[model samples]
Target: MSGPIRLWVAVKHGVDVVLARADRSTGTVAMDRAPRKTSDFDRNAVEEAVRIREKLGGTVTALTVGPPTSKEALRDALALGADEAVLITDPARPDLDGRGVARALAAYARTHPGFDLWFFGEGSTDHFTGTIGPRVAAEIGAPSLSYARRVSVEDGAVLVEREYEHELEKVRAAFPAIITVGQEINQPRVPTFMSTLKASKKEIRSFGPSELGVQPSDWAPLARRDRVFVPEVNRKRQAVSGADPATTARGLVDALRREGVLP
Candidate 1:
């Protein structure tokens, strides 16, 4: 808050849920070969970080943990207005579970301290565990604000408006805190051609598990995902026909009531 706020936003190159195709025969999603993109909500996080920096004067560093391909997410962040990018990945052991990823992030934060704010999405697009932000905050002993719909920095403290099922909760924490934002926060900006080109040329700092003092065993998944399958849904295809509009409407209502679609 003094000189210039150092803000870090975490992004993930997760499966593009829209583009992902499920195998009809196996009734499972082909995660291994699924096309990937930056997690949708993380884009909102990056946008909010940039907006805050623009208003309060600060630098935004985007961080990601995954395989080499994860850099794609960083590039997207850079194009959106991040000043720097850091990628924590181990080519030898590319895959890590939620717990392992939290450890890697905590290790990086411990090594490179002094970040005033760390931002993240409420959850990833593919796997919405909603744990990484809180886990990292726990590891670093920082206040964690999850499901934030509105965030602002003032008087050396971060203020947040979190959404609940029944009400909106207001909270505040000093600098060096973590915030997980939901999609309701703000719409992410699309990168222009020039920005995208510049971002493509920007240098991204890379690191592995060892560099972060994370052991090989620690990188393994604590909870393994045995399989992922799309649930089979059966729909009743019925139509209501009548000669008049009122008759048709009444018939439709009657059918919906019979099917328990209306009460």
Candidate 2:
């Protein structure tokens, strides 16, 4: 492991989509204001990347695509252990779909050839499509390992243990590969006050689509979300009451029998 393994990690800024509460009529989250944090799954991938960089002796780069709010993700990555960070955003302020994101990342990969390994969470919390890793690999023409629980470098190759069917399987691939990690991979490290303070000074480079060799058409989403809505519960609610506990119990049993709950 004399030569460091250049690691690249893709991270997503955290927001609780469910907690925002969707309006079925509008197909949008009623998020007047929502607390945001880094997703646990993405954090796991970041942690693994740092650990691999430390063991194999390589620089770790955290990359993300979003608006100004996404800077938090880059800083968080730096605090957690990434040597550097990159933020890719749009000047016009538009949303990118999964395919668009993969394309942009692929263009980035082509522009930056130093990274020997790329890491991602099994799925993003906001969009659990689980398609980004494979899509990026396809775009970049690299080997990929999905659902990896553990990863290591050995004998000039990357070794990974991943879930296969009902059991785990061991697989190996040459360098310059992609890995999408599951939550079982490893626990992410919490940054201390010192680390947080130090991370503030780390370099955080910003890039636009042009800088990454990405075109508007290349980054345009394949599909757009038309709307969001919660499904109707379509059920009835009833209450059974009694003056005493014994009476309540009897009434409950009688009601269950009447409703054909008891066989």
* Candidate 2 TM-score, true structure as reference: 0.85
TM-score of 1: 0.92
Error of 1 at 155 (Å): 2.8
lDDT of 1 by residue, 1-263 (tens): 57899999999999899999889899888787899999999999999999999998889999999999999999999999999999999887687889888988999999899899999999999998989999999999999999999998997899999989999899999998999999999999999999999999999999887788778787678886788888888977677789999999999999889889897
Return the lDDT, model 2, position 19.
70
lDDT of every predicted structure (CA atoms): 0.92, 0.82
Name the best candidate (by TM-score): 1
Per-residue lDDT tens digits for candidate 2, residues 1-263, read 33667889998875676576765566566432454556668888889999987776788999987776878888889999999998888867445778877887788888888678799988988668999899999998899999999898876678999987898889999888999998999989999998899888887888888898767777776786764456667765778789999999999899889989897
Q: Kindly state the number of residue pairs that clash in model 1.
A: 0
In model 2, the runs with Cα more than 4 Å from the true position are 24-27, 30-36, 234-263
- Model 1 has an lDDT value of 0.92
C-alpha lDDT (0 to 100) for residue 64 of candidate 1 = 95
